[model samples]
Target: MRATILMYHMIDTPVTPAEVRFCRTRENFRKDMQLIREAGYHVISLKTLLTAIKNNTHIPDNAIVITFDDGLACNYENALPILQEFGYSASFFVVTSKISGFNDFSWDYGFSCRRMLSTSEIIAMAQAGMDIGSHTVNHVILGKAKTQIAIHEIRDSKAMLEDALGHEIPHFAYPFGSWNPTVRDVVMTAGYTGACSTMPWPNRPDTDPYLLRRSEIKGQDAPWQFRLKLHFATNTMPPITEMRQLTRKFLEKTGVISLRKF
Candidate 1:
């Protein structure tokens, strides 16, 4: 009944050095989807997972949920096509204030400013059966903000997104994966059925819906590394795994092994 929730950001080439960690090439995204299919995993929506958590019912052990944060234009321009080709459903968490605008706030974190998804694109995705969730009004870091600011961000973002899509926005992702217990309570009071966090682990029936753990899929991961994360629901390697990777790197660096072999 354990399920892994995979987190992704932009689906395009890195716009800056800071973006390299967050961006995944479209080709790689396709390959990742293909790998998921070949691995016999079932892709489920966030809503389905939340329902299962609520009902305390059993879900497939191989169930995985795909989610994209920030609602970048590439999500519609690139990722959507691949996801549709695979007939997979994903949840998109968007910043309410950035629809149809540039992500100027990214500059504050030293990330390259990129275009956010347009309202039209978001509505189209929702129409196409993608779950549209709320990230926040301004991507405020709820855990660090004042109580009133957190309340405003949590409640207002949901209201704004619902108004846009003409439907309930029942899920949310903590901005910057930042949330304390108070922030969690705010989200609960704001009417979110579930919330996503940056913690890397699989969710179980006993796991808190508001503190749902997600394993981030980074652009730097190799195909094998991606498989490991998918199966293990974590990127943190154990001691033996770390030693093996180090040994492999040393051998490759010393010319005892060829990159082609890997």
Candidate 2:
């Protein structure tokens, strides 16, 4: 059966990094989660995805694998509890280098802040039944880097997580949802079973495992918007990818400086 994985960033709260504008607020996030619950989609972990795809096991008609990028502290503080309450499982692909404390955040936005999850917080989440994977030691756009650098980013990250968690970190995510065929080969060599990309659409049974597509969830999308995004791309390039590329080009042409500030 086909499945969808939703990628999200910050949940609602205040004190966002001056540059991080996509942080979803708690009120809206709560509403979205509620909507998910109402929709009857089973919020599952990546393990379920792997198992179903590999074994062709029977799964619910609508299954979703939820993921949180950057390991935000708010994911532990705000999102985890709600997830537990909802009996929803999610995966957190952590940046091993960012485990120093709760104060260090990603450089994705124009500014930086302490929003990512700490080692202790991550451990707690894992113990509480969340799946952990590698997002990299730091978030790097592997598609743009040299092969050697890409290998280090992809391979070293899984190693780092294994050392920390004392277990295999079998899954991955592209730092920016960016990948090329070379990048995919490196990830496979790094020993990851799968790597989720920011492709943004429903994945079919014939989907590529190494370059698994995911639905990019933003704080701004309502249930209707999510539905449309999940269904827009079927046989060709995903709508989310097309939308992102088009939006990027439009922004570049118009000199909006919205997504480029970071």
Candidate 3:
């Protein structure tokens, strides 16, 4: 069976004329969940899915791993109930600094309400059956940072998550799919066993655990487009990775300062 892990952001009922990008309106989310259920798929946590993959444990024919990044309040308020309604679970990768629920993240539009889960909220979610993972301290794009900064972001974030969750948070997601050979080494050194990426790659076997590929659910993809992506999405790895390196080199050559994957 092929292991498929799906990434999602917020699941709120989109406010009229949705202003956010990369987030799903509540109606779409409902449709998605309904579609998954109707398709006979089981939505499971990252650990459950990955353990099965790493250990060759068997999974039902239609099992799928569901995940949410950015630790939005909507996750607790909106996404959780839907998953629970369907008896499913998900893994949440939260940026630590924003946990105060004070709107810390300023970059993206969903960030218009970007706030990390409060320690209390995270504890609540954990208690309510959600696996917690780290996005990083400040959501820095590690691949472009200096080596020392990159090391801090990678190592320190993992430690922070372990401290907050009071257990191992061996899984990770680069602040922005920002990955490279050096970044991978730092992540491993930081004690992460498996990490996900924002890159578009296949979820079939023999993937690099340190750079696991994931499908991003941008707000723009229609359900049919999503189906198209799953069937036709680029799953190639070696050449794609080489191309990433070449792009980095070009950025360096031009000092364009690309922080794309991070």
Every model's TM-score: 0.91, 0.81, 0.80
Rank order (by TM-score, best first): 1, 2, 3
Question: On TM-score, who's better, 1 or 3?
Answer: 1
- For model 2 the TM-score comes to 0.81
Off by over 4 Å in 1: 236-262
Query: Model 1, range 192-255, lDDT digits (tens) per residue?
Result: 9999999998999999999999989988778887888898889465555787889889889988
lDDT of 3 by residue, 125-242 (tens): 8888888888877788788888898888777877887888798888888876787889888888888878888777555556677777777765656776555444434323234467
**Candidates' C-alpha lDDT:** 0.92, 0.74, 0.73
Question: What stretches of model 2 exceed 4 Å from their correct place?
Answer: 14-21, 101-108, 230-262
Superposed on all Cα atoms, the candidates' RMSDs to the truth, in angstroms, are: 5.8, 8.9, 10.3
Error of model 3, residue 172, in angstroms: 0.5
Which of 2 and 3 is the better model by lDDT?
2
Q: What's the TM for model 1?
A: 0.91
Worst 10 residues of 1 by lDDT: 235-244
lDDT of 3 at 102: 56
Off by over 4 Å in 3: 13-19, 108-113, 229-262
